[model samples]
Target: MEAGEPTSLQIEKQSLHDQVASRIRDLIIEGHLEPGSRIDEAKLVEQLGVSRTPFREALRTLAAEGLIVIRPARGSMVRKLSRADVFSMLEVLAEMERLAGRTACERASDSEIAHARDLHERMLEYYRSGERMPYYKLNQEFHTFIASLSRNETLCEIQGNIMARLKRIRFIGNSEPEHWRAAVDDHEEMMDALAARDGQRLGDIMAHHLSETWQRVKNVI
Candidate 1:
């Protein structure tokens, strides 16, 4: 075996868990599962066509990720974000996005920068067209692209975790037209900083951008 290669059993186990996790994650993120709803393990296992073992493992994995809370007698429920949780998470997201923007400005290639600009423009069009769902999806992709362009895997992972945790709150904000427009404008500023390749300015802009979102959504969450 190669020094870095995983054993066959290990690879299989990871694949099983990831498959199970992805199915469950989709349900939660798409709002089908609903926050604070009880997870019916029997129903989920039937729907996913997986057995108890893998289903339970997937639940444990999600619990570890802070997406769900498993209580002993009460069973598993989707994690509810308190107002405080929203504020604290936004604070962390602001810092993470700032780091991502700074690194992207420093390390992203010209092609990467151009791609980010294209995504931003496309999202703006979607926003203007009043296609809320598509715009929201594209908006998420744009931020993720910028994070990936930073070329720091750890930073990207951290931002991904933050995004996952905040997805429900973000959806709440997006449902409001005024907040949606404000978010689009912030993305424009972020794109401008990336175009200039000014790491310092990009960092500051990203932090402020996330901070504004926190301000807008904290009271509602």
Candidate 2:
């Protein structure tokens, strides 16, 4: 092994911390630990069966991702967004998604598009069966995959960053049956335009879908 190289134990520990972060992230995104609510660090740590070290590390990671806010003396709390804040973020996200969809149509190969289609189909099944969490997870994955098809590193990075912050809001947006069905319909149109390689239409749908997302979730947030 080279000098300064991390041992297997080190690697395992890092992965453990990452896993803890994911667990906590899910807790926040699923509203188990709701927005603007202070985290009960001791209780959560014990409940998760993790040491304070890794738990605190996970919290710091979330803080960096804009999902949680950590104060100097006070404990951490889930980040809260105002209606206007959501609107502004969605506006930017819409533009990014618009560009990503258009570019993906022009750039993505057949196999790449097929893979995204597969994910969408899986998400659709979850929706059909009324499994909200899995459906929401796959929905986010599909959108993120579309952005990757553009093959623009910076665009994907920015989109993922913004998407992370809005995961909770977006997931709960589909709490109503009507809104959930509407979102599924948007994905259907998006996939159709993508398959046709109609960049213009795909871009338009992407932009409009995000705008509608704001409408669906604004009341809740």
How do the residues 96-214 of candidate 1 rate in per-residue lDDT, one tens digit apiece? 88898899999999998998888888998998899876786787888899899888899889888888788767766767788888888778788888899988888888898878887
TM-score top scorer: 2
Residue 211's C-alpha lDDT in candidate 1? Answer: 84
Best by lDDT: 2
**How does residue 124 of candidate 2 score in lDDT?**
90
Instruction: Quote the lDDT for 48 in model 1.
Output: 68
Model 2 spans with C-alpha error above 4 angstroms: 1-15
Clashes of each: 0, 0
What is the alpha-carbon lDDT of model 1 when measured against the actual structure?
0.80
Q: Which regions of candidate 1 deviate over 4 angstroms?
A: 1-27, 30-32, 43-61
TM-score of each: 0.76, 0.91
CA lDDT of 52 in candidate 2?
86
**Residue lDDT tens for model 2, 1-221:** 22442222122344377878887887787777879999888877766677889889989999888999999899899999889889999999999999999999999999999998899899999999999989998888999999999999999999999998898988888999999999999999999999999999999999999999998888788
CA RMSD of each candidate after superposition: 9.1, 8.0
